[model samples]
Target: MGVGVLDQTGATFAEYLPGMRAVIIADENTWAAAGAGVQESLRAAGIDSDEPVVFPGQPVLFADDAMVLRVRDILAATGAAAVSVGSGSINDVVKNASDMVGRPYLSVCTAASVDGYTAEGAAITVRGVKSTVTCRAPIAVVAPIDVMAAAPSRLTATGLGDLFEKIPAGADWLVSDALGIEAVDWDVWDLVQGPLQDAIADPDGLRRGDLEAVEALSEGLQMSGLAIQVHGTSRPASGAGHHFSHQWEMEGYGRDWAIPLSHGFKVGLGTLAMCALYEIVIGIDLSSIDVESRLVAWPTPAQDRARVEALQPAPIIRESAVRASAEKYLPPDAARERLERIRRVWPELRFRLAQQLMPASEVEDILRRVGAIHHPSQIGVSLEQLRTKYFQAQTIRARYTILDTLEEAGVLTDVVDRLFAPGGYWYGRSPEPRWTDAS
Candidate 1:
């Protein structure tokens, strides 16, 4: 399936649609931006198409069950194939809805905002928790450079942030491989790594809305999505940073009475945080840790539940967190066993992790140059929240990340504390700097 990144996106869509009727799925904003033109293109191609299915929303459209049902109903009633004409949310909703109706769909991307456009999974809210629902990849992806470049700079920057996540994401995969959780797939890794590095090497053009930069960013994100498709897992493009983003979304932190930051932006901030943690892990002296003492201090299940309750996440999130905590809450004997394994392989693991992650400072500088938000505070998360939830993020997913390694070693708290201390990555910038000192 060819991903068309051309000026003639409408023409490309016409070629794909052929004689089939298409239902243009888009939100109001997307309809204004590119949906109308896509409809006209179908008309010009002599293909029957119904009036566009314009979702009612302002600023953003969410990929929730209701929206998915609405689109599926429209497609079923009209007996038309779907042609999603928007970015992340619209594309995700259509992807899931089309799968429900067992119909192939095409994606007309309007912004370089996320990798979901071409991925096999839809990032949707299920039962009030942000989750990835398995779905079919679009039959074809059409990203017009002009449309992408015209997107708000924040959207493009968010796209850059999403691609930048691969740095820490790759490192996390290395960690998982070291721990025998999941081995890396070099084929899938190669799909996004080279393009990701080249896309962000110099983001000045992206900031200025240059077409080349827009194409590069759009292509990079699309490739990332394809990477996920090839691997049959999100590991190639998601890791610790993505877990942080999912946690914030589940808790409704950034979305409370405010426009939520894009997924890329949230993950970008998360990427920085994860990188900082990686630095700490690399510098740790394994011989110095008193494994017995740390193991004895490990929190019991009761204590873990109490701490999770104190955070007061949504009921569903709290339930999930409490359940997941069991996996990480190891007894002294179990902890000692894990600690011994970690100690035996600490040097090799440290070297692999260090080799995989870019310096936190370097990642931050690139994001800043591209106008991406690098701090969690930029998206309304407080230091207290970060401190409380950083570890929780690890529990929310069964995946093993650098966070899991730190937690198992009983240094996660120390690492978070130092990350928020003065001269640290998040120092003086979080909503509550005083919390850092107390921790």
Candidate 2:
């Protein structure tokens, strides 16, 4: 299906009938940014809302009881047949809330920061923990390329992160299918794969603020939404990476942390870390490890947090990475062979990944460009914070991705060392990869 566009022309909301009765919900930031245009558009479309609900700040927390109560009151008063949300958070709120009321709603996306815009479930914080609750996908998703291109660079970066997540996530899904731990949806995969590739290949299109890139991103996100709808769960779009993010949210550290990264940003980092872990693992052999030696003594979150805080620049992250590797059940040669086999099957794997995968190097560059924090130092997030998130991430999600695989096999510590090694693939504070040397 072709995309649905509703430019800021102030006529988009007219697509719905005036008599149809609807409530418009938007957060303060979004409301101020585009409120006039949206209201004008609705008015032009012959749709008039007696009440428009606008909340302060962004709707980052889905389980805010006050917001829920307010929305419920709005719905009750409007007796509206539907809702039209003007932001991602607003969309999730309206969508999930509408689901509760058996009402349908449409959304006009304001930022590309999240994939939830088109997904069938809302990621909400319930009782101070991030939780994914199933909701109906919007009946329509509207976006104008002009509006999207003008969004902050970080929002675009977040969108890129969301798109990048599909790789590790898809791999985990495939592995689950192989192990019979979860069911895979080939159709869902089929739908998203093309748009995903298209988006990755043309990331320059995004950096250049190309309208086509915006369109592709929008399309890819929507495809992800449909995939969730098809699977009746987020398994198709989220995996270990998401778990890591969720775990961080649940641990309460991320909540109280000095600087909080977006869900996509945290998940993106996890994806990169997990992919690196997987590569290290698949490069080895599996049967050689002594089972007893491979078990994680399973440190407490507090201990893990302390270890993370104690991380000294590059050595610390690498130590944890290497530690993770040492415990992996798979031997280095076998793990390497698996990667080689995947390469044999899809010769373009690395090339394709090079586009979407935001390594620490890429993240560093972007962070510098946008003046955003890229280092643990920049955010004042000590190694303890990282440890807390990492450990918690393993606990929240059920997927057997790289972290789980390593923890299960007992090579987690070794992998941590390699991952955080100075000059390693993760970026910054590095002794450098031993094989490559300065000229």
Candidate 3:
């Protein structure tokens, strides 16, 4: 929580897990980053512990079912409280594992690479499907400003990318609220939005390892997790933006460990893509959306299920589509009312969304300032590839994102196609990754 807080890892443990035996779980690289210091400090403060478990980092660590089970096994054998000493993957591993054994765990962040530090769910790949699993979040997170500032720049970029996605995520909530699909919790919304701009305001400072900037970024990321914890659903923090990231990971963009994609890298592109999609959305003439025609052409639940089955996406993706489509499918009577609602709310809803969403160009500028991936090709995904994913992504999540709303109104495909066509907002923008950055 401050400079040199790594020296107080023991104090964090005492305050959060008093009188309990501690188990340190980290990957080898993270062990070197902060694990070793935490171990020494805990002992110096008189906390008993078992030998730390350091996972091999040869292939780059990822959060998956196997890693969770390994940590769970360690927890079961030791019967000790856990200390998760890493970012993203490592924290999720310990978080999910600790949940399995009904134990409390705290986080000792080595980098601000993600906001899952105090999140209620763990992003884990179970049986090849990368999805969030419901689990207990870390009890407390100890982020040392100096330690975070010393980590690699790309990891900081990842954290910014993760943090920035919230811009469009907020707009997506507006979409759901307008459609009556979901309601926004304003208190929880402010928890993240209140500090978002200031938290990520210093991309250049962050690049130069400014301690102030680092602390802001760290606190901002933690605030996001706190918001997630308060809401009890990722709906407030996730939307079409995350669906794009999940689509990439589930279909094997993440299967090749040699090149190794960071989650935030993909999410950065997803954020930009969603922003671009929002641009198209704001221009659509919703007044003439032809609601009656859409309802007439709407697929029956059985037919929609058949349509999803026929897309022939990856099995897991297809499975998610089927489940989501069935859950969201509405009979013509209800759907007629929904479409009418959209037409009625379009003007005010669009205005509200405009207030909420950042322009794609500005989002890209912020990402470039922080050295994050802001283009499709950075992770080997092309504009054409992205175009295809927009359609596939809508079906993968039952959650009501703007994509779902557009599909209900029958404009999702046409709008996305226009974005990639010549003269569209994203037609020739950042075709290759470019950054005017500080470091």
Q: Among these predicted structures, which one has the highest lDDT?
A: 3
Name the top TM-score candidate: 3
Work out the TM-score per prediction: 0.89, 0.74, 0.95
Poorest lDDT segment (10 consecutive residues) of candidate 3: 430-439
Between prediction 2 and prediction 3, the one with superior TM-score is 3
**Model 3 lDDT, residue 81, Cα:** 97
lDDT string for model 2 (342-439, tens) is 33433343333344343445544543333223344433455445544555455434455545545544566676656556644553552222110110
Off by over 4 Å in 1: 1-19, 56-59, 256-258, 287-313, 327-337, 429-439
| Candidates by lDDT, descending order | 3, 1, 2
For residues 315-341, could you state the per-residue lDDT of candidate 3 as single tens digits? 778887788878988899998888888
* Tens-digit per-residue lDDT, 13-90, candidate 1: 567756678778888887877876677677766677778778776756878988899888888898888989888888
Model 1 lDDT on a 0 to 1 scale: 0.79
**Model 1 pairs in collision:** none
